[model samples]
Target: MCDHHHLRSPAPVGIVDHVSSLSENFAELVETEDYADITFIVDGARFRSHKVILAARSEFFRALLYGGMKESQPGTTEIELQDTPSVAFSALLKYIYTGRMNLVEIQEENLLDILSLSHRFGFVELESSISDYLKAILNIRNVCHIYDLANIYSLTSLCNVCKDYMDRHAQEVLTCDSFLSLSQTSMRDLIARDSFCAPEIEIFRAVSNWAEHNKGQDPTPILEVVRLQLMGMHELLHVVRDTGLVSSDAILDAIRIQTESRDMDLKYRGYQVLEENIATTRLGASVIRGEMKTALLDGDTQNYDLDRGFTRHPIDDNSGHGIVIKLGKPYIINTVKLLLWDKDMRSYSYYIEVSMDDKDYERVIDHTGYLCRSWQKLHFPARVVRYVKVVGTHNTVNRVFHLVSFECFFTTRLFHLDRGLVVPTENVATDKNSALVIEGVSRTRNALINGNTHNYDWDSGYTCHQLGSGAICIQLAQPYVLSTMRLLLWDCDDRSYNFYIEVSTDQQKWVLVVDRRQESCKSWQTFAFDPLPVTFIRIVGTHNTANEVFHCVHFESPADTSVGSLINSVATVSVTSGPPNSPRPAQAQQGPAYPLITVDRGPSLSRSSSSSTSSRSESHQSVATATRVHFPQYYGPPPPPPSAQQQQQPLLPQPPPPQGLPSLHLGHYAGHMLQQQDVPEADRMDIH
Candidate 1:
């Protein structure tokens, strides 16, 4: 009896292995079609399936087979599906049994049909899998078609994915034939998005072209959504006026809004909300130049007036004469926002490259063949980069490349650009109230940092205090090396405010970093100062032109610990090591050591007092143990003499000119502004 009971049971199988085998068994059951109790005739093809399996897997099937539906009645096993394709129903049946479908094996057109059928059959898991697969294959050609399908099916996730892809590649997508072929509903949803970064005029052209292609289709509903108030007066008269798509009355109203000072819509500039721009002055971002530097990261992108931004000549040359942005430290960046000089209708062609070590660079975007204008929001494959260089290959206006503002970021969000600019949410002061201690006597302190830019008016969307009542103070969560600040003064009416800002590490002993008590300020105000350790900021309003109240809509300080270096307009830079026995400066030792690149920017772009002067630290006292370096100024060769034949030649069609090629004409009045500054020999010393 003892010998008969000694045999051991087989070793227990793992749960994963058991489940895999179970799935395989179920899959075999689907192929064998044993004990088939139901049949579906789809597009004239018969499919045998089981009633118990179908009822358990899908609610739609359960209702049709077991519920009070007619298909559940006696002798109703064979049901003909008029709308579904045989191939799509075949795939659906397999997925219902095995819980897996090979999307790669199905054609895209057939897969789209499967997606529709999955929605009808209530196969949510199968629908989601197909939607994700569509996003992976999205391109300029198929994005519009997919977007239309998403809209029709009310697939919110798929619609959002398609919309974001369209917005990121708006300029390219706008030109595709599929864009013109989109349904009116999809077209309305597209142009209505604020995140679409193309110029308002370009959107008008695209819509007008779409309307022309789809004749007999009433475009009144679609045309009503084109945000015509955002278009310029010049575009209204020159481009949109003759289109005949917009009614005469609508055109007049848009033109009137542009001229009226009371309309707030005129001030609404399109900005990307998808990602925060980390390439900022407060984050140690700078436009590195060989000689005289420019304030390309000052956070003031609206001003494209001469002397407001920077320009480089012979950008098409191989000498690497273009814009270089140092992002303070290594950042996982994939997007770059470039505000090209758009005061004119000129377009530019360019390429972008990034580097981690500043030596080995990788080219990411190359639009050197096509023309791009206004706001250029470029996205590339994500990579770790510390340096980004934008090289202009061609300019329709001239040979020189004019860039008003530059920004870079690691965009992870898929939201619309609802805010005033592309300032990162983390860097914005109002994102976390608990982390910041805000103190002030106002209508609502929350309104000041609510991140709402377009909904504000005289009575709402702002924090207000009677003049001289008390200063609005904010205590940061931690100390940061600060240098830049951005604020929006309530501009509902023709009112102005005179205010001053002070920063401090502790509650006591404040330092007046910005003083503007004498001059009037309105709209968006951005200022910068020498970097310092700061945790507290106080805004004191001295007077207001409108009654006795001071109002502020938004305030932000984009500060990071890695922001001690100089990023303002730089004229000269020298990085030298201190004597071996010399002690490092306390400020330098606290964080990363950054070379102070100081320049004489003449007038204060900070809008501070005229008496204020740029502060420069002595080179000897600020130097750390580093090699001394000098960036020499570059003056490009002169352009060739005018010729009738050269004037007729297209700029982009020809092969790139040789290195040291002369720059083309830079307009009549821009010659002096684009000239390279002459650095004195004494200031060009290199010490090691």
Candidate 2:
């Protein structure tokens, strides 16, 4: 058994890739009609194919060709597809037999027809290809027609593209000849949206032009949704009514617009503004202020309108960079909502302001920069104001900004933005789900975001046995204002370790947010800094203060619970309720809470940058609770006695062990440190 071992490929060692050529051979058979068993007639063109192949590929073909009826019998084998085009049918048949589809020859008009035919026959791949092709070529002339088709087929992504295209080309779409063909509902919806690039008055003209196209039909109903007061009083009277299409009620609505538009009343307790026809899905997807709140509530973060992303210019820079909300009436607003763009490589530095009148703005949130796609719930002291403004002054990646949604509220409703946030890890052992942790940690992720502190057991917590400078990172799906991080350290090993903390909006460029690389503890750590928008957060281990292994029990954000109560002293050291020289040890002093004193790595992050030191009174304090956990060590038999041949062979140089770290031992929870008295050898389990 100890003699020798060898590895070899017992069977043929290499296999060539011939699947594509095999598919080509099957493709050729469609043209040759070799072993073909059925014929299909498409718009007078005849195509030959095998019955077994067609039955295998198409559900419709299988049912018609073998469903035990006259069509399944041997006598009549021809299938007539009167609706399919010859070119498309040929392509469809070839795909069924050879797993190949050639779309170069199909014309645009016929492609849509084939798209329908493919669905009728249950050819999934062909249908998807047709839809993708149509989506790519969408332009002003065909978007309206494509939009109608998209709705019919429930092709949501394609329909969204059509809507976005129309949003960017609103002016052209309004004047285009297709505008005359639109139904009243479609025109009304277009006019109601806040995303119109040409402003409110242009929509009035478009309505007038539409009425003229319809022999001067009533345009009053459609025009009522617009803010009539925004137009000059003379323009509303002279140009709008001159069309002879206005009604008495329409004139009344316009008269009310002047007073009603500026009335900031919060009579309604909860604004179900998202349901109003004024904001469509297309509006939710843009940078415009009107659609901002709708998108956030819709929970569709991935879809956004690039054309609507904008920032304000100080001196007529032409940027429409902010959103203004007139809260039906004023209430004391304590919370603001923002869901940043999804994994977008852009950062917007903006502010939140409130005012009784739109002109004299009082800053609610000063200069803040965000790069993550996470939802930010900004809380402030409740202040009464009718108007709210979100203004952007700077952008990191580009002048334009991408925002999935925006929201504001009078009540402070706690929102768990990272309920499903998946944290990414570097140089760590992952369990079955690619989540970082050693074995036995089953519910660590849930413990992190589930808002439960002091929630620990064998099934929850993270352990890393492997050695090196390991770090645990969470990549946010969106940028957010990361104000503080609350960590519940795992003290399973009486061992302690220190690690640096960092953050970044763009993953490639990093900023050192905290230097905790020298702190050691079994207690909770709260690293609170100024509010900064970050897409990535990392915990880089630099040293194991007393042992080799690392353990983390839970992680929580501010929204889950109120900031821990503030303590009198910044660094609070706790002594056990025991006599001096007692069995238990005293806990070290917890670090001081922040008005951060940061140490920058280099000029890469300038002192004046958004992550700069700032004064903020964040309310937080450490939770002091002792818990104990222990892990067993794996034991193996000693190595066999060195063989005569191994002893004779000269030793080779071994790889150098990792340097720059102190040596240590493991396995003792924070709650139960080792007793001062040594354990008896007999009681200790030693198998090595």
Best by TM-score: 1
User: What are the per-residue Cα lDDT tens digits for candidate 2 across 201-250?
Assistant: 67778777777788646666686676665566777788766766566566
TM-score for each model: 0.44, 0.43
TM-score of 2: 0.43
Which candidate has the top score in lDDT? 1
User: Distance from true position, residue 3, model 2, in Å?
Assistant: 53
* lDDT, model 2, position 26: 77
- lDDT per residue for candidate 1 within 331-387, as digits (tens), equals 566678777676644667778788755665678776664455556665665665678
Q: Scored by CA lDDT, what does every candidate get?
A: 0.63, 0.51
User: How big is the positional error of residue 473 in model 1, measured in Å on the Cα after superposition?
Assistant: 15
